[model samples]
Target: MLSKLFSELKRLPRYAILLAALTALGMTAGLYRLYAGLGATTNMSKVFPWGVWISFDLTTVALSGGAFTLAALVYVFHMHDLHAATRPTVLFGLLGYSSVLVILFFDLGRWDRFWHFIVYPNINSALFEVSWCIAIYSIILIYEFSPVIVERFGNNRLLEWIKKLTIPMVIAGITLSSMHQSSLGTLFIVMSPRLHPLWHSMLLPVFFLLSSIPAGISLIIIGSIVSDMLFGHSLSQRVLEKLGWLMPWFLGLYLALKLGELLVTEELGLLFSSGKYSLLFWLELVVGVIVPMILFSIKSVRWNRWGTLTAAMLVAAGIVLNRFDATWFAILPRQGVTYSPHWLELALLVGVASGVLLVFTILSTYFPVFVETMPTRKPQEAAVEAGRAERAPALSGD
Candidate 1:
């Protein structure tokens, strides 16, 4: 067994090995944090309750929106050609949400009771809604990803059954995702007093949901490029261009809403006067939204793989920065109360992220995560086949 393990380990590329090493170290740090408690291992305090973990969780959830966004386009909106991108996007979403759950567990002071929300529901709380949506949607993602596994095992009958459930499952997943994506912003609504005016607004939930559309799309574009480079699984340029085309509309809507809110709330003046907050705000918008929006709008850039990839990276980074701004940087700190992540916090984050990437690589390598091997039955076709099967059996009895 030891020899076999060594042989398998030897097959990993240098980057995978590095990722594995970082994951191991991070896990060790995470374990120590659990033993020592948040107070000992984290820099969070009464005034600075949320640290990097919350920011990461929010950012990840937003980016992971690709799973539902793509599902909607392919299944709900009947954009059949984009089906090829859904499997990888969904797998990324599953891993992204799984990472969020793990980080949330560690962030909890009483990590043991992380499951309490399941039994003791909070109907009015945005956090409660986000929690349920993420948990249930993760299960939905697993369900959505199951046909690939069934296909790998050549289980045609079971695969058909799973396919039969696909439409309803995709619908449920989309609905749940929409709820939580917006609700994440709603989580900060109560903090309007502490959150900087430049980043705060009554329309935060709308901004979050709108921005997620572009972020999710961008992640899918980037994921396609990475999959091609790493595993030779590439979505066609036309499909990628179509996906890229979506960014400007959503980004534009987000921009309009953000500016409109500031205008109505009379916070527009703060845009230039808020010093560093203004810079942070513009940094997120220009680099993440405006540049990518323009890049994606251009026909040539959208068609160019490297151009799309660069724009996508900016969009993803921008959304992540926005999350950090809202959750940490934009908050008005209490007198003499400041926060920075401890080394352990940083280690755990890197470890978790590294672990997700490593697992994505292994899973894609083994489980047909790319589009070529995924089941290709459209929902309508599957339904028709099921109907024919049912009718044929009954007719034969006559």
Candidate 2:
């Protein structure tokens, strides 16, 4: 029976096969690791509850900002030029956040008692805020993403219902995302005493929120490029250029605030020092912030597809590295304890990431995720546009 199943699976596309193999491997390893227990399998302890999983959780949540950010851009800010990019961005967020929730299930110590946050309340806790926001926002992502599936199935009635809730979903998603994205940083605010002097600041939440904007924008850019490359479709040139043009301003604001934090906190000397934290600080700023700034600021780089892609990759990588370093290294650089994820632990991360990619691949393949992937609009939107068209001639004539 297993041999037959493998043979049947082999008939599918190579990408699907690879993803299934990886997902199966990762889940298998994860289950075994769970059975053996975290103490026996990994480097987690009382002091380091937030380890590799937390680092990834933070990174994925921050990147998921693209969903709400792009939503706000198109719906709240009236940037219809970005409409083409919205669905794909939402899809990215849904996959990222949903995957993080799964990874986090294993990360938290009391995995079985995950529901404690819902029944037992901790109003004062930053994690409580993050937990609630993630829950609500992920639901919003699902509702927001459902229309694509609805439309694909040709369910006009269901699609109409989904459309009516679109604007509300976008609004609520932005509100919740704004809360939780910053609260992730707030989780570390209490660690000021333990956190390295370079990263320790009361304004950590502000930094977290601000950096998320550019990181989200960069994520959209990279997603666009990848969709184009893999799906044989292209986004509107004007859309990519506009997003590229907008990236530098956000990065500049984040960079300025980060520097201002250093200045006001009087940590300029720490930035110049040759410590490991100092090195990471420079790496985060120079490579992640400054390089992307220059790249996006350049007309040639921002305008070209490959150029923007390279810049976006750097931006994403920088954000991931910064979050990971801050969580593990800068959190306790002086503690004299080196913490690296066990090989199986890393395999699990890779497996989870592969699962996300595979899911995205499958969804984008079957559903109309890209602008070019499915050119039809939801029935309500089509009707609204049609109604507007009918009135446009009369209004102009009048």
Candidate 3:
């Protein structure tokens, strides 16, 4: 078992090298930011207490909802068709949530005093609830993902133990994710007076949860394409094709909700008003929402890899814009404030993103993240390789 694990690790030298480089760079920037303070390094101000880190955290965690969604389908809905994609989804989810936690440390004004969030435990504070939920959800993700590592390392005892905990962990994950995801939107509830009426609805939490479904699935589709291109194998085409079917339904529901909210609130006209906010609103609706839905509606286009990739990219981009619009852009004008990230904040964002990519690359190379064989490849090719191995026996005999 040890030998097998070591062999897997040894096969991933390039990933290890990349991870090392990213770690060095991230730690250096992180340390510098800590020593200098956010004002000294980042473009953050009293007006914009949150910047790149908050945006990144919101986007990444929303995308990580893929894990809970997948788990729900497999365990609760009995959709075993998605089972193959679960492990990789869980792994990515864990990394995504963990990365958000790390970024939050850098985001706080008093980095050293962050422990007060846990130690003081303000029961009435929404921020406190969000923080604790995120912390617990991260732990749930770790446990959900640990089974794969145990299986790969051939630790039967550990694997058995983890399997026993899977049911409880899945429940915990669903509950925690539901709380924080909504809480993320609720973070803006206090700022309602500062947000544009078009975006300040009480249903922000529902909109956030609804939008997350498509965004999470889109990330999975894009992640699958990247794995196929880089690793020379497809994970599950049937699952992805089914995911294509699922996208439109979620997109339709989300669009309907937004339109309904606008109509009910008499704010639909804001889509055309001339301003930066209007431009962003239209951009989010048109590029992020409308274009993808139109392209994906065509059966031929939905099945095409490039089309799917484009849609996924747009959906992901739309989610980012939506969050920014909700948390920053939508609130800024009302507050009569603006913000742009300084070089240090930008560097920290890049460093954290690089770190996540580095970790994913290493793990995929060393573990069974991608399928062992191409699901879409010809059977004859596999047969030919097997035949060649048999024929080579004569040379060894001689």
Candidate 4:
């Protein structure tokens, strides 16, 4: 027994061990932060209450949009072919949101009062709406992912019951996701005075919602590629190409809205004149949006494995930059004060991220999260199996 256990431990990957170590350190840091309070652990203040944690939370939530987008495509739009990618994407989304909730807990100054938002209602507040939506949507994700669990137990009856409610749950999940995704943008609308003009506008909510679609699609594409490489579990290349095909339209729309808003608001000059802000904005737009948009528009690029992966990575990177710019970088720091996340803050963030990856690795390893994309049987074998099945009743009767 001891020898078998040792052999199993020896087979564990070096990276998995590193992730476990980081997660352990992160947990220690998180516990310390809760004991020491935000003042001691974070670099946030009245002027910069939203720091790296908030930026990470927003970015994660945006990327996690894949779960709903894929769900909508499969269940709502009847794109049954895309169902193969839905389970893994949903699991990714669940872990992504789980990390967001953990980071939010650490970011809270009054960590013990985290439940205040639930019991204390504030309909007028955008944050209140976001809180409720994220909370409800997380539950919806669990419900959506429950089938993966029930399947392992061979609980066909329970699975059928869950399947019966699947459509309604998916609809509810989509609705909740849309609400909070837009509401996250609504958060910046109120900060217009403090936020740079390059990023601020009356249509911030619309911009956010539009951008998340491509971001979600990009994440799904990337996740598929990664799973294929790491675990040999993934959707077909043609399916990935189809997903890539959707990117250009959404990216183009986002580009149009962003440029149109700048034109309407007369902030085009700021695109060049705002110094570092201009550079940051263009970094996200050109590399993250425009370049990937042009690449995805090309048939050869979208069809090639590496090409699609590259485009998806760019789009995902762009979303992360856009979220960070809106949440932290673009926000004007008060007079002489500036915010840089403490080392512990970053450590905890790393830990939470690593923890999610670790969990995903374990789940995907044990669960039938990835659909079987490879053929399992040869033609001769299948023919012989069918022949046996055809004669089974006659043989039994004899």
How many clashes in each structure?
0, 0, 0, 0
List residue ranges in candidate 1 displaced over 4 A.
1-14, 373-398
lDDT of 4 at 338: 78
RMSD of 1: 10.6
Residue 2 of candidate 1: its Cα lDDT? 100
Cα deviation in Å at residue 9, candidate 4?
A: 7.5
- Please list the residue runs of candidate 4 whose C-alpha ends up more than 4 Å from where it truly belongs after superposition: 1-14, 374-398
Candidate 4: give the clashing pairs: none
Candidate 3 accuracy as TM-score: 0.88
Residue pairs in clash, model 1: none
Against the reference, the lDDT scores of all candidates come to 0.86, 0.79, 0.77, 0.86
Please identify model 2 stretches exceeding 4 Å from their true place: 1-12, 333-335, 372-398
The C-alpha RMSD of each candidate to the native structure, in angstroms, is 10.6, 9.5, 6.8, 9.1
Encode model 4's per-residue lDDT on 46-151: one tens digit a residue: 8998889999999999999999999998999998888888888899999999999999988887878999999999898889999999999999999999999999
Q: Give TM per candidate.
A: 0.91, 0.89, 0.88, 0.91
* Candidate 2: clashing residue pairs, number: 0
